[model samples]
Target: MSNLPPQHASEGLSLADQVAHELREDIIGGRLLSGMALVEADLVNRYNASRNTVREALHQLGREGLATYVRNKGVMVRRLGVAEVRDLFLVRRTLEIQAILGSKPLREYQSDRMLDAIEAAELARDREDWQAFGTHSLRFHQHIVGLLRSPLLDAFFTNIAAQMRLVFAVAPDEENFQRPWLERDHEIHDLLAAGHRQAAAEGMNRYLDDSEHALLDLLSHPTRA
Candidate 1:
């Protein structure tokens, strides 16, 4: 593989952004694994970046709850404890159900956008693209909430998405696990667009329940890094 200096890695991306994006991908894709130690000098040599830049990048990840920095021991990729997993799903359930129930009658165009997000998610899943799948999956749900037209709901869902990213890191075969949801999500969007608000809400609830169950099942076997 060709090695490029981190400072010149990509155009239009700051050094800190480049470092953060690279490390974030490693964390989310399970390449770095949970609780893996993040050494500054090692990363600095690996990315050919300055220590200051690496620290700034790690700070960003830390803020997202993707990593934790400890004095003397340095930083490590954050893993979701069992309780953390339960809390994440609980919060997600509350936000999503509210979004669905509060959504106004969906118009045709609005429904189309929702369908588009589902299709994107499905395609990403088929390609085993975990990063794309996670992002598109969040978009699918966020679009459902967007129908509600509430800024508070929007912000809540956004934070939920970030937390879900950590969960995705622990899930086995995340793409395969998300496939069914993608199909069901498309149907839910169709139902809402058809103005079947009650049915849409019901479908959303079932989706959340099943998703939470699956994630919990996966978490039952937390492997060491």
Candidate 2:
């Protein structure tokens, strides 16, 4: 228990949702490793939340497939098997390819969001803010999906983005590792804005392929991780 003051658990969002977000982010960001038991009493004390809130939060995480409830081991962060990582990336490729294809001609408002997200990503990179970059990069792509004007697609892509980030958290040298993706993503955005949707989609496909390959390779050989 570090001496950092606990945040008021009831400050804003519903207690359960707030706790869920905190725990989810930590698990996905690698602050909490896979298979680490989530002791509810410890969390209640750490976040100054009630036990019920902690349990509700754990349940939420389990629903997201970020945690598991064991018969005697309590809640623990999930460990993605190699096959699962590949399946996840395959899902990402399909969804993102569709998002780019459907986005068609990019609008000014959507471009603005993309640029803002890119700038935020660059700033986060400069400051070594991997967490922020991971989050904002997802937002950048979500904005692209939003431009397609399909709420269903937006929701689908959001879930895909979350899972990708969770997979990314387990990789080693993530800061340097993600640079290639960032570069390709930047180029893809430019192409999309310049009315080259096909080219942008192509670039996105290649990016997804490389990302999936790298992540799968890492997971297969944790000794190199």
Candidate 3:
């Protein structure tokens, strides 16, 4: 069982949301493996939350594709198949490329966030903090998507980012899985900073293609976690 950080009863977030947040962290952090059953009773005990809260949290996770409910089997952490992985990358590539192509000339705030993400990622890599590196990498792409100022798009990417974490968790070598992308992320940032919008978009497309290939390769060959 995962030990969640304590939340005060008076905290502003709803009980369900609080439970969901903790569960999401466990799922992303790999404490809860893919396809593991999420028993409502277990969660209620683990979180000291009401049955209703646990149920609602499961529903929210289902909505995010982090968990799925089967009529007879109840809920379990989601397992992505090869086709799902392919489709995810397809949608991600399209959305990201559009964000890149549509990005305006370097607004200082946006550029700073992008550059900060890159720098943080480098630091995380140096420390061999794969989880932090992954977070920063997602932040880097998120800032790119943020350029469009579309809340809807931003939310979509956020959901995809969560799913991507599950993929990374099952990958063979965490460090190797994430290592190559650090430089690629910097390249994309540099291209955009230099005001080469088209070039940046193209670079993003190639980056996504390479990422998809690597992820698919890992998915096709399961490694014992």
What is the Å distance of residue 7 in model 3 from its true position? 14
Cα lDDT tens digits for candidate 3, 119-152: 9989999999987788788889888889889988
Which ranges in model 1 have alpha carbons more than 4 Å from their true place?
1-64, 70-73, 223-225
lDDT of each: 0.73, 0.74, 0.82
Better of 2 and 3 by TM-score: 3
- Give one digit per residue, the lDDT tens place, for model 1 in 74-124: 798777766887887787767767776777777777777787877787777
User: Weakest 10 consecutive residues, lDDT, candidate 1?
Assistant: 1-10
Query: If the candidates were sorted by their TM-score against the true structure, best first, what order would they fall in?
Result: 3, 2, 1
The candidate that achieves the highest lDDT relative to the unseen native structure? 3
TM-score for each of the candidates? 0.70, 0.79, 0.83
Residues 1-225, candidate 2: write the lDDT tens digits. Answer: 322224644445577877776775564444776677999999999878889988988898788777888778978877777787778767766666777787757778888888898888899899988777777777776776676688777756654565666677766777766655567668988998998878888988888788778878887776564
Compared with the true structure, model 1 gives a TM-score of: 0.70
Candidate 1: residue 56 Cα off by (Å): 6.8
Badly placed stretches (over 4 Å) of model 2 are 1-15, 25-33, 45-49, 70-73, 150-156
The most accurate candidate by TM-score is 3
